[model samples]
Target chain A: MSFDVNQLFDVNQLFAEICEEDNLFAFEGTITSEEINTILENVEARMAELQIDLKHRKKIYNITVECIQNLYHHSDMVPEPLVEKLGKNYGQFVLRRPGNGYFITVGNFVLNEKIKFLSEKIDKLNSLSSDELKEMYKFILNYQKLSSKGGGGLGLIDIVRKSEHKLMYRFYPYNDDYCFYRLDIVI
Target chain B: MDTLSIEGTAKTPTVRFDASKGLIELKGRSIPENSIEFYKPLVEWLESYAKEAKSQSTVNIQLEYFNTSSSKCILDIFKRLEAIHKNGSEVAINWFYDEDDEDMLEAGQDYESIIRVPFRMMEVAAG
Candidate 1:
């Protein structure tokens, strides 16, 4: 089945649907440099409206950027013929105002085989204390050689450590070959 | 000896390293898309600064959050500073963390414990 690159993702509609009032200003869209910038700006503006202080603002901004970049770099979606021709992957990000903090959700397609490894890693990270997480991060950073993207399980650890909150995750079956994984970090 | 200043972005930190003044400061968040590309020049500047460094040198790091890649880069910087300190020069590293940020404080301690240099971890009020 041939899918047109531009037709594969409706970024605007996705954003609108996810940003509804019921979602508490949550938004979802494709992963692009421009989109990333917009998300940062919007989150900052929302933080201002919510009277979030500058320090927490910095933390939220940093964590959000890291999560978005992770999706952009590691999301399981390989370029389809049309996407490759257009030079982009179809990714989504969602943000919502939850409790005393904001929750950022990111979703992307990935290979079926990767889900098990990712789930295991997330489970392990979720179970570790802050101290254990730091030790784990150090161990990974020291022993793990640099990959092409410089990731060696430390990014996820950093995300969990910085958030200081539990990670919420869900997996949706897309097809036999690909599944969509959604991860949320509250800051 | 020269100074290098790069503005911080949403995914990166501000870098100010003045070789002549022997003052290096890194602040803000760092999760750069291309960690190596962003840090290579800073590493190069430190390499040059280590040789031309006259007088006591002080490097201050005030970071709120950094990804794993930046963590490695931070370690690299500390190693360079340690080398300079070993070459019969004065070097002091002041690592500042938010008062409520125990994770950062512990991270600073981790770095301090690993590198053989005069390192001070300070807890400052969050801004």
Candidate 2:
């Protein structure tokens, strides 16, 4: 099967759709390295929109990059011919100003079987305190033994640790074989 | 043995290390397109710095945030610094964290506990 590049991707439209709502600052289509750069540029531009200092901007920028990359790396679409022909698998990310801090949401499709494991992992992560999370991260780093495409077993742990709030996620059925997983990390 | 300084971008952090001044600073965000490529030079510079560092050196880390891959690179940096410190030169690491940012503070403590260098945890007012 082939997907039209134009129908599959529209960077500006995605950005506008994400930023159109009140309190929304920026957005990006498909979390690739190039997309990451554009997101960073939009973030630099929106620093003034959000009226935040350079340090805050820096932190937010880092958090957004981490969040987006997680989406890119952990997305369910694999190295398949169709996805490759489509150029990229699109994931949605949004950063919204929520009072004192920003709320970040990144979502992409995942295989149905992965949701249970991910949910269980998040539940375990959610149960831990910061210190416990650190300990768990260390243990995972030393013992997890399996490296993702990014060579780190600590992505979810890092995301949970960085965000002040609990990691929120949703799973929506995309088809019989896959479901869309949305992960939210508020910074 | 050589000093390296790079400007901080929205996605990547600013890195400044002067072996001559004994001051190494890593500031800004770090989520490089390729974490290995971005950090390779910095790690190599540190390896050389460790070999030829002066009597005492202090590395200051003021990263607002970093990704998981960058976290690994950071651990590698800290381990190298620890090695340099063990070679009889005084090494002190100061990690600056924003007030109320328990995450960064805890991360600093984690690195401190793991590495053998003398690490000081300092709090700076959040921006």
* Candidate 2 CAPRI classification by DockQ: acceptable
| Candidate 1 structure quality by residue, lDDT tens digits, A9-125 | 533454465556234434444567677667777877887887876656666766776777777677537436325532356666666765566777777777878888988889888
What's the DockQ for every one of the candidates? 0.45, 0.40
Measured over all alpha carbons after superposition, the RMSD of each candidate to the real structure, in angstroms, is 5.1, 5.8
TM-score of each: 0.82, 0.78
lDDT to native, each model = 0.74, 0.73
The local distance difference test score of model 1 is 0.74
Error of 1 at A139 (Å): 2.0
- Least accurate 10 contiguous residues by lDDT in model 2 chain B: B29-38
Query: Which ranges of candidate 1 are over 4 A from the true structure?
Result: A1-25, A53-58, A76-87, A150-152, B7-11, B98-103, B123-127
Error of 2 at A95 (Å): 3.0
The residue-level lDDT of candidate 1 at A111 comes to 80
